[model samples]
Target: MKKNGFKVFIVALMLLSLCFGTLGAQAAYEKTQPQTITVLGTTDIHGNVWGFSYENDKETTNTGMARIATYVEQVRAEQPNVILVDNGDTIQGNIMTDDLYNKREGAHPVMTAMNMLGYDSMTLGNHEFNFGENLITRLQALANFPILSANMSRHDGTMAALPYTIVERAGVKVGIIGLTNPNAPRWDGEKVDSFIYSPVGPACKKVVDIIKNKVDLIVVVAHVGMYPEYDEEFGSDGANKILELCPEIDALLVGHAHSTVSEIIGNTLVGGARNLGREVVRFDITLNTDRQVTSHAVSVIDMAGFEPSQALRSEPFIAKTHQETRDFISGGVTSADGTTSGGIFGKASVDFQPKNEIMGMPEGKLRDTAVMDLINAVQLANSGADVSAAALFSDSSDIPAGDINYGTIFGIYKYDNTLYRVPVTGAELKAYMEWSASCYNQAMPGDLTVSFNPEKPGYLYDMFSGVDYEIDLSKPVGQRIVNLMYKGKPLSDSQKLTLAVNNYRYSSALKAQKLVAATKEWESPNSIRDMLVQYIQENGTIYPKVDNNWKIIGVDFTSPYREQVVKLVNEGKLEVPYAKSLNVNQLKKDGILK
Candidate 1:
């Protein structure tokens, strides 16, 4: 009996030891496990640092660096492993950046805000090169973090900037490669003369190959979008090509299309944030002791719920700059070019745009309006081109029947684009017109009103001055521009003319789309916005003058049902038809017409 009892006691002791050993082993493994690393990204901020619109002279709630800063701070407090980055288009937008900071010789406020936000790195967008190389170099010097572009190289064969950066958190190394859009040279003519841009895929692959062995994971921060913007066959400036070429890429953050994206392709995680600081793309990656990724998740956090960080707004230089910008728009400051802006630069005799028949539908694009005429007029006068094309950058853009300030001018023509005079044959011009006319959706039989194509942006629909044309919406897309006349005569296909256009349209639409095969003969020294300001200042008071040269025809809005739908949309009873065209059939399908 004593031997049996001792045997039982020894077995019980062995079991207890085994349990304790297992617990100790589990604790050791937990200690060796890597904590989840958080990567936060922003793109296309466009100089909205304080969440204020200098053009409207009002505070915006939904987007800004200040709001992003608040969210970033909260994340940092919650986790020790966090990295912040921007995907560029940061420096050039708004009157504050383009008119004031960009022309000065001091520290850029956007860079200052970014530095204060603790951005680890930023990829250069095409707009970053809008101002020229000197400004880009200055901005690069001012940023505490690296402003990278792997695809850009100097004419002398030197790298333009650091291609990639290594960020270590929780003993895990993350390799972030930055790629700028390869279309920079095409867009910023003569501005990027000293640099060479290679295809994004090959450039990214080269950088990934160089740093893959040195890091636990590979991430690409590219200024291009996930999909192709133009010329899908080129396939050089998209993130999908990078994914195809370098399958080892663990994650990618893309920009330049101002889109919201979150998806997983193969083994790689892809994410994109909306532009103007409206959202932040975040990735949480968990790695094991062997530095292999075990799990990963991505999310896009909207900044609408987040408060603007006072810490960012109150930064001394930023605060001072903000106040100065306000004062400049109010008409107290003189620009570097010796021009005093703001404080009633001119007067408008009437509202330039007619009221929209349907809410959210821009009447300016449906027909010729004085706003587009003013822009095209300025372009023609400055470039000496026989014909000029200009876009209504904003649907809400107008010259009110009152005083015109710098802000009003900015509202009309938002981008800081210069003028370009390019040669175009009659066939090329007609093709270009056809492309612009394609922004509208075909008017179906039951359609109550003409609607724009949901896939096409309003900025791509240009209005032509110095020509008379009729857009027959009843016809198919490529055949819509009928009765195209120049100087009261039908424009012949073999005629040749010079087209005055902004540099952006010249490159992005004419050259990039292969619609026109002509080089620019002349380029404006100042921005088109600057030229408008000069025109307004010199004229003192501008009158709304619509030549009625262009009109939209053949869309039947005669139905009483059309009137009912329009009334409903205007009275807030029906939602605006933005996703697709609104027609009687669709209304009946939705049970609204019935």
Candidate 2:
């Protein structure tokens, strides 16, 4: 009996020992649960290749797609578990799209290059809507990776999804869902007409619910940059709207506003703007079975750091692509000059040529006088009728003449604006003049704020010379403009006049369209930019001269001139030389010589 009991004990002990050893090995595996995810992502590339930027100067040899390809290669080599993504707006804003548009060809060369470099996913941006439905569909077909938008769909409210992809790395499944920004109509205009955009919050929740249960991790590529890179100083992206509403997401890959944020929001990790599309973001994540990420690491790399990968930088293909791009920009045909031409801006000359006048249009002090008069000449010549207040000024683009490329033309006139001749009753005309004066209202922070917002910089810094006005920062928003008048006449309420203007501001394409609503509208036969090109085409070389028409009215409203005399005599105020001068024009002409 004792021997039998001992044998039974030994068998039980052996079984227990084997079970304990198996448990120890299982615990070790659980502790080191192998998983690492890196998303090499970018946004708002806007076809900027070789780090292209014309904002500061004529041209810059910035980072390009080929370099980015090489960098993507290097990153993948270091870690095979990385996914490459683009946030959106990759279709336009460069010469690549211009070629495609002009030639009626395929999608961007940059897109092709990105595909060769291995982009795993992408989203739609507002600019993508500018290409219209057909082109977007074409682009969708060409994309090697899934282009996604949770909030965007066909004309109705149904879910539009590409076959959702699950990428497994180290035995971990990551589900990536795409969410596109919904402000397409406000900015894109007629191009993407009936495509409905649902509110982002509900759509996000739906996607999260759909993916969270099925995968261990969730990554959202958000094109909704709440506070766009364009709005840096605010530190508050308009995008906070979506983030505030959607908390179910585990990780967000943000774009649109184009700022970077490696942030924790409601158990989610969000980051963005991987170096202007010249780089990608790599993120490492660790997760629990509840499918929640417990730890993570993020890094970004610039493509310019690497050599051009052979797949993207082929010389024969580049030369062929270059000529094709050029041809498309030249309106499917090249001008006699080796450059492409757009619009019809020509030195058509002052229509009447000031039959009895002399002194070369009277050496105008303001720039728009001769240009406005010249436009009036063409209008009257075409209509055989007297017209009032024709506006002609250089289109607002910072591109230099030497650097005039396809991007310049597109930026200057993204709106397909035509010229309009509107006839308004004198009262309506006076009201419009007042409102136009109001449109002149803008305040630079440097002029008033203790410090300027460096992050924001000012918008393009426009210098409008055609219609004169004033702004007083102290005054309320609507009351800043003073004593509005036109053509040196106190504008009568009942009198009528004809006004010429660009269709963009005329129709209030993006903003309030009602400002110029009172006047009857007409489309100019050619765009103002086109008119300029036509003018240049007629002449070999070009020099724009001053065309004086408008001037600052109600100078007395500018300040209390007489009160300063008291301050000056009594030493109440510091001696500001020009401040004391009542006649600004005379003061300027007097020069700086003491």
For residue 481, model 1's alpha carbon misses the true position, in angstroms, by 1.1
Error of 1 at 460 (Å): 1.6
The 0-to-1 C-alpha lDDT of every candidate, in the order given, reads 0.88, 0.53
Q: How many residue-pair clashes does candidate 1 contain?
A: 0
Q: Taking the tens digit of each residue's C-alpha lDDT, what string does model 2 give over 1-594?
A: 999999999999999999999888866565466556677777887765544443332333335566667777777798767877777877776554543442254545665666677777777776676656776777777778787887777766554545246666655677777767665765554555667776655666677777777877777777776464423443223455556666766567777765556666767677776435655556677666544576887656555556655556564554355455555454564432234554222323332112212111111211234334444444444333324443222223322334333344444444333556666555554444444433232333212111112332222111233234443433433454454455565556565656655443443321343444454455566545455445445563434444443443323433333344324434634233211222333433455212
In the range 376-484, model 1's lDDT, one tens digit per residue, is: 9888999999999999988899888888888898898888888889999888998999999999988777777777886788899999988899998888989999999
Top-lDDT structure, candidate number: 1
- What is the number of backbone collisions in each predicted candidate, taken in the order shown? 0, 40
TM-score for candidate 1, residues paired by index: 0.90
Error of 1 at 125 (Å): 0.8
